[model samples]
Target: MKILVPVKRVVDYNVKIRVKADGSGVETANVKMSMNPFDEIAVEEAVRLKEAGKATEIIAVSVGPAQAQETLRTALAMGADRAILVQTDAETQPLAVAKVLKALVEKEGPTLVVLGKQAIDDDCNQTGQMLAALLGWGQGTFASKIVAGEGSIAVTREIDGGLETVDLKLPAIVTADLRLNEPRYASLPNIMKAKKKPLETVTPDSLGVDVASRLTTLKVVEPAKRKAGVKVADVAALVDKLKSEARVI
Candidate 1:
């Protein structure tokens, strides 16, 4: 089985985000960037599957600006056989990314596709489902556990009340959740080897997918600062304050 994993590049989670001065978007200029955390879990899972002898090859893919090659290299260092970067400077929304992955799926003919549940930068959480729908394939999303069988994979996913398990046939999609697995750091040797791994770059136009943004951002602004809390002397004072100031009573 050939497992394909899609990764994303985003602002490092540790960095404090700053709104652009013009209310355009978050300031990414000279900001530290890294692979999406959830996608790292997805890549680790695929590599484990290959190590377990259930998968023959693993491919890591990313859709973003040319800088995203670094993100794909991170995946290759994690044990992916190769990497593919769908180069695009435009904003890659959920729908456009799904279309690009769909085109790659057709060309690569992988048996299974795995991706993160969401990218931290956008937090849109729509790409995996959109890709599954476009391909008309079975989907098991937010998967915490995955077991591959003869021609299907059983996925245990987290739900509102509890966990739910579903069996998806081959040529299906699975989105990795937080508890799926802990990601492993790339070793120095592997990191050096990743530099030599085949990293193919293609344009959205080459994939025949029009990546024009359908949604427009009216404005982007920083959230309002939270107000400081006030202390009350006793329960009676708290109740009075709630009634008069908060109006909860």
Candidate 2:
């Protein structure tokens, strides 16, 4: 069986984001970039499947600008056999991304597709579900555990109050959650070996997929600042302040 993993390049999680002076968007110029954290887990899961002899081949794919190849390289170092990059400069939304992945899925015909449940930058948590809908396949989202078999896969998912397990037939979509597995770092030798791995680039148009942005960002602004708390001398003073200034009596 073949396992496909999609990764993304995003702003490093540790960097402090600042709103642009014009309020157009976050300032990304010259910012540190890294592979999306959730995607790393997805890649690790696929690698483990390959190691366990459940998957015959592991392919990594990324949809973004040319620089996204770096993210694919990271996945390759982690143990992907090859990579495909759907290169585009246009700002892509979740739906468009899902369509792109669907196109790739049709072309690749992988038995399983694993991806991050949500991209940290957008936090939309929609792509995996959308892909499953487009493909008319089974979906298991926010997966914390995955056990693959010859004809099906069982997934343990994290829910609001507890956990739930679902068994899906082959050719399914699984999205990784935080507790899935800890990703291993790519050693220096593996990084060097990844450079020799096969990486093919293609445009979205080449795949017959239209990636036009359906949503518009009118403006981006900073959230309101939190006010400092006031200290009162006594309970009576606190009550008086709440009744007078706060009017919460």
Candidate 3:
């Protein structure tokens, strides 16, 4: 089985985020960067499949600027066999990204595509489904469990009610959810080893996919700051405050 994992380069979750001075986007200058957390889960799942002998080759792909190579290298350190960089200068919408991945799937002819359920920055949660539609393949989104089979794959997904299982034919797409697995950090040795991993760079035109974005950002703004509240001295005071000052009742 060959699994293609699509990843993203985003602001490190641990770092404090700052809005750009011009309000066009987030400030990224001198900012620490890392792989998307959800993508990390997807990568971990793909690596586990390889470790379990269920997957043969794991190809990690990232679509973004040249800096995205760093994110792809992180996937290699985590055990991806190869990397593909779909070079782009600005952030591409989910639809455009799906188009790029669809082209890749055709070129690589992989048995499966794994992706994060949603990106941290955009939170669009549309690429995997869009790619599946574009390729006319089945999709299992928010997958928490995966069972590789001879001719198909069983995926346990998280639904609003609980968990649901679906069997997808080979050459399907799967998106990772939070409960999939805890990702392991790359060791220094692995990081050094990843330097030798092959990363093939490609352009959207190379695949003959139109890169027009389906959506456009009309405006960007910071979230309103949460207001601080005062604490009451006693349980009786709390009840009084809730009824009067907080006006709950």
Top of the candidates by TM-score: 1
Candidate 3 error regions (>4 Å) = 230-247
lDDT of each: 0.96, 0.94, 0.92
Full ranking by TM-score? 1, 2, 3
Candidate 1 ranges beyond 4 A from true positions: 247-249
Question: RMSD to native for every prediction?
Answer: 1.0, 1.6, 1.9
Q: Residue 86's C-alpha lDDT in candidate 3?
A: 92
The TM-scores, one per candidate, come to: 0.97, 0.95, 0.92
- Candidate 1 lDDT over residue span 24-45, tens digit each: 9999999999999999999999
lDDT string for model 2 (1-249, tens) is 998899989999899988899998888889998999999999999999999999999999999999999999999999999999999988878899999999999999999999999998878899999999999999999999999976999999999999999999989999999999999999899999999999999999999999988988899988899999989999999999999999989
Lowest-lDDT window of 10 residues in candidate 2?
24-33
Which wins on lDDT, candidate 2 or candidate 3?
Answer: 2
Using lDDT, give the best candidate's number.
1
